[model samples]
Target: MTKWSTIASSLSPDKMFLMKQAMEQLDTRYDEQESMVWGEEGQHDTRESAHYALGLLLRGSLEDVQMASGIIDRVLEMQLTQQGEIYEGTFRASPEQQAPPSGYTAWGTFSPGYGYAQQDALTEVYRRFAQYAQLEEQTQYKEQFGRAADEVFPRVWESFDPNWREFIACTFAVILENFEDRLSIKQVARMDKAMQRAVSTSLERYVSQSIPTNTNIELMHLFIAHYYGHRYEQIDWIQHAERGAMALLDDYRELHSFAEFNSSTYYGVDLTVLGMWRVYGRSVSFRNIGLQLEHGLWEDIAAFYSPAMENICGPFARSYENEITSHSSIGVLLYLALGESKRHLTSINCETSHDLLIALFGVDVPEAALQQLREQQGERFAVRQFKELCERDLPGHNRHVCTATAWLSPQLMIGGLTGSHNTNGQMHHATAHWLDEQGRRYSMRMVRREVGQSWNTHLRGMTFNVETEVSRLDITAHLEAAVPIELVFELEGAALHEIQITADRWQLPGLTVQVDAQAPQPQVIQQGGRAEIVYAVEHRDRIWNQMHFRLYFL
Candidate 1:
């Protein structure tokens, strides 16, 4: 029951400035006629409109609140109201979108049921606006907010996707804890039943399996749910969450890195959820653990962040955008914590609204992390980190079956997972990043091309070992099948003069590559600013089973 006024006043100067800037950015995106913001895809985005409304509500000015009310009303109208449909109670991604096909699993489209965790932000916006309406004695807005919550609450338990269940449940718990008083008695009863079902299903799933620790952000949401279950005296829910939390903590304690390591987008999610626990956990142990883990994560970010490049040097486990200078959620978080000096490096745009949680709760980045972020220029160094993956060795048991490595240096960063062979499409395996002679940054990552597939995939049976100097990266790849395969190096942000290829080796402005396989010269395919340096491992119409390459970035 914290008030917006209290939260606003409690924000540090840096966060306060960031919040105002984020609000301004969101406000500029608002389309007055449509009562929503046009997204990057040039459509009226329901989720982004809700995020914009939330930022406006947080701003709490007279005109800002009025604009927020309009957006909220429009977004609520976008929710599917047809009973008995697959997406009956869920919101649409866009104004004219329909429910997805019966077998659809892609969550990024304008489909009704694929909003995933992004839709959870709408529930938070409803709760916060409801609270504001009650405080300001705005009766119409209060009723509107209450009805919006009622419309969405029953659907929280409807998602069977394990990847997003905890995220939805965590937001549901927050709504129940904060906005339950505003709901009608019938609505509250329905919500309570839905929550029971949700918790029971979660408990049942984890009974025979270990909790997932690889996706770092959702792991934190599970911990947040555990805290709420303890607060509500739900024994099973509390135990399940506690088990997951301890397992995750123990995993981090072992290697001091998350399985989803060094992500620009998800790192913000990780930090936000951790901040939720740190600020609002019911128990001292929960609060302390949150603080400890948050500090450790900040340290890791600082260690890999290159001030000169203005980006986190990666071997990223998951990444939405390769360049940090683009519109990114992580850049907003960094700007808030690191202050004005980071403004030029930060890309503050509509996506900055993603930092609403951090703005409301506040951030506490450690001084040690801050010092490294501020001073880690012109000093040469190297870093190697190992992360454990959860995989099954036998039925109903999980072990550290795969390990991922990330090696970082002052000028270049390279590394990847040892046993990952499939393409989830986000794994940056065998990745390298360096600054060219003209100080322009470039990224090179290995991708596999199958026989008939036009799109490149991340699938590869490969492993890397970094030498002592960290400037040299050794890669060994094998082919499981006899299909002709080509290991392509996709280079982005390079110009014509920045690369050269010879019969024996390849040279980039910042790194050199040498292959030990008896293959022809590398083929260069250029598409605008991006190029793919393709190395085919086929000889005499038969693909080789194994090949080796070395990258020297010194």
Candidate 2:
């Protein structure tokens, strides 16, 4: 560990401290049972804990190895069957049935998607353990891991489409790498054929329908496809992957900037897989492209990070508010530094990071880019990027408008009003988004006109025709009904500014909220500096697109 001075020298002092804090916390967050809680008294989930341990184990500290091994063992012990299929428990007990962990409002359920992810985590941990564990423990765990894979891998392959899950695709890639010879030779051969077929079928089906939404997932598919024995499919999928990567890069380049996309978390997913490709992919040209993209993304991502606050205080065009500035935000710079130099730096700790430190050793990166990373600290660089964020367009399906921020010396405030990115649920009218300095969020939602309305109302699709500027944000909605509706804004520390109503318009700060077929009679109530606005409109056949609205922060 002391030999890592070269790596340590690459990070600024602030990042070094953050890395220390992250790793120390990872040490404490696990219990004696090795269950990972969200906090000291948070709910214990086998899946989340496994992920944490996977990264910790790669830290190569004696204490980390012990903690990670304990977690992997406990996760192996918790696999249970429901409906003739194996799934890891959400807790040590039936977390689904048990009360929520202390201080939590509710418990969690085991979903097929999450179940697939947990199994992937276990297999990944086992893969790493097999490589580095002592002989006897290694053999024992290998046999246990093999049996788990035999049960879960087929089911996971059968139950989920690989195209939809990059996590599983990447997991499959790992299985291909690690499970050989450890399992019964005959079983390994058969499993390989089956997984190869499954991955191929899903890749074909997915490409036929749509381009890959995630770069990381596509890279996994490419890595597997390129090396798979099916030469024709290998070449075919590799071309497909290359095309997709080009398009994604083009999308960002056209904007001349990056959008956080729908979730801030995907940033990590992209970096991790790209880092994996650069490390493991056989082609030099592709690895170089990956390295370039990795460096560019790190620069952009770090620009949002404020070392002063140790948070990603964002002007993200689209992101889940809860994760906007989470303490456990993605470790882009940490991973990039590891990917570039292949030296594992203790100063590069991030809770969600995995075996890339060990796995990607000696992978080459451009000296210029590595030098740039070695020189960065957040606040000064981020302050400049704060200006860039305001000038640039971080577009996402046109569903979310641009972001606006106010940098008040030491504090940063970001806000954006957006509609749902996924259309699986009923159409929401409008969601007003705001994130204050402390990561406190304020979102306002209006119940859709579809509630209690006929299912045919759902046939009426909605679009987000919202717009934004540096100081203001606006949203508009068109409903099938002309009647006035109630809009609810969930507030933390926000207050009402001004509210008024007339026959034709409900007035706020910047614009009017209107519905056709009847004049809107709006009511404004202010309580404790916070306000709620309710208005009624005449019964009309539709709330046309012209019902422009602006949110007023009180």
Instruction: Give the candidate number with the greatest lDDT.
Output: 1
TM-score of 2: 0.49
- RMSD of every candidate to native, in Å, equals 12.7, 15.2
Worst 10 residues of 1 by lDDT: 105-114
Candidate 2 at 54: error in angstroms? 5.0
Stretches of candidate 2 above 4 Å error?
1-165, 172-195, 210-216, 227-233, 257-262, 302-318, 325-328, 331-412, 415-460, 479-488, 492-547, 551-554
Residue range 1-554, candidate 2, lDDT tens digits: 42222333364544444444455566566667535534434556544454555445334456655565555455444433222222221123313322211221111332323423444455557756766665554345766666655543432333322343234335434434532323346544543544455455446434532222233455556555554523335667667656655655665565334444323445555566676667656567667666767666665554444433333443343333323333223533344354423222333333233333323332234555445444434223122211111111112222232333322112322334344332212222233344454444343433334322322121223434344433233556544332223333322234335546444444444334453322234455566544454433323463333345554332
List lDDT for all candidates, in order: 0.59, 0.41
Model 2 CA RMSD to the hidden true structure, in angstroms: 15.2
Candidate 1 C-alpha lDDT tens digits along 1-554: 32344445567777776667666677677899989987778787776676676666665566666676677567656544443333333456667553332332212233322232333444456546656667554234645664554454322223322433344344445444544444456655654554454455444334423223345534544664576577568876666666666776777787787766777767777887787777667767767777887888888888778766667765665565567655456676677677787766556654566555567656678998988777755544435454533221222232333444556656666655555433334555567777767787888776656543443333334433323235655666665432356767778886745577765566776667664444446778778778887767674576666666666555
